[model samples]
Target: MADDQLGEEYTCRVCGFRYDTPTWDGGSGSHDICLCCGTQFGYQDTVLDGVWSVRAKWAAEGHQWSSPEFRPPDWEPGTQLAQVPDRWADASVLAFKLSAPPLPAMRTSADPEAQRAEVLGRFLRDGRLTHFPATGREWTIVLEHIAAGFEPGVKYRRLEIDKLLKAWHGKPADLLSRLTDQGFVANDDQYYWRAER
Candidate 1:
């Protein structure tokens, strides 16, 4: 089916509320309701909170319904954000770290590390990395912050690691593992210290 027919992440045209409603009614008719505001458009607003299968469109000016006080429905317990992996650095995983590695070059001039840094800066704006285009230079770019602020053998906490790898798009474990495999960082129990010479 068409993407629009399958529904979309729609924002209420009246109250500016968002809902995952389809643009088309299955077979009978529209049954959409805005959970945010009590606005029913071709929907029975009394059943199961409300039938949410109505389509919204642009009126001559806009929607005529007055904006109601938005009340978001409660999610089912344990059904929200279950895949996030609760990576918070509370009392579980005390800290994390990565070691700096020297760039290797046996041929013509080309700073792989610098290139990685530039790419990361372009993709991860403002120290946040929600999504980025896949590229072959991922690990190289992740290595940019290696020697900048990290000191060898220092047991830095997860907060520090978060700052250093704020722009990295991969899981923190993978980044740490890569550094350890490359002999850059050493795993001392739970802390990641720089591998000493």
Candidate 2:
């Protein structure tokens, strides 16, 4: 017989254990052994009263699709075929497991802008910056802490500003653009300085 002509599912008759399809080497290995008990499987021993052949059993159950049915049932208008594999787990549990994500720690700050700045400043002050990290107030309120850190009458290089934001994993160019647009910071191609009043 050809590989495609075999029954995709089989059972261990001794222990009534169910065997799944595609057992490694396509369907050939599916019925070769009982996985639960390690018992050597013998398909011929399963035949009862000379009526159980793999092809014949599957065909009688309307499963073997390769050959035409030798005994297809006579059906009336409303006759229903019996359902196979009667019980299985609900899919919702599997779907939930697939879709769920791990939760992050909850924050309680009421001010959205303040909260964003706090989160943004965390990596900035973790000793990851050569510009020196300011903790406490700086970690809670970013813009003021950053502005105070800038020296008066001193032009800060764009590279320094880049290092500042890069320490926090922020895009330096984008932050400069946003700051300039808000009229609270001024910058050219090479330098940035606080325009605080």
- lDDT of candidates 1 onward, in order: 0.38, 0.39
Give candidate 1 regions above 4 Å deviation: 1-114, 130-136, 157-170
lDDT digits (tens) for residues 52-136 of candidate 1: 2121221222323222222223322112111111221122112211221221211111686665665566556555554432222
**True-structure lDDT of candidate 2:** 0.39
Cα displacement (Å) at residue 70, model 2: 68
- Model 2 Cα lDDT, one tens digit per residue, 56-167: 3433455322212211233211111111111211232233334434222212368878666654544355633223222222232444444555676667787887776565
**Candidate 2 local lDDT, residue 185:** 66
Clashes of each: 5, 0
Candidate 1 lDDT score relative to the true structure: 0.38
RMSD (Å) of each candidate, 1 decimal = 21.4, 25.6
Lowest lDDT block of 10, candidate 1: 76-85
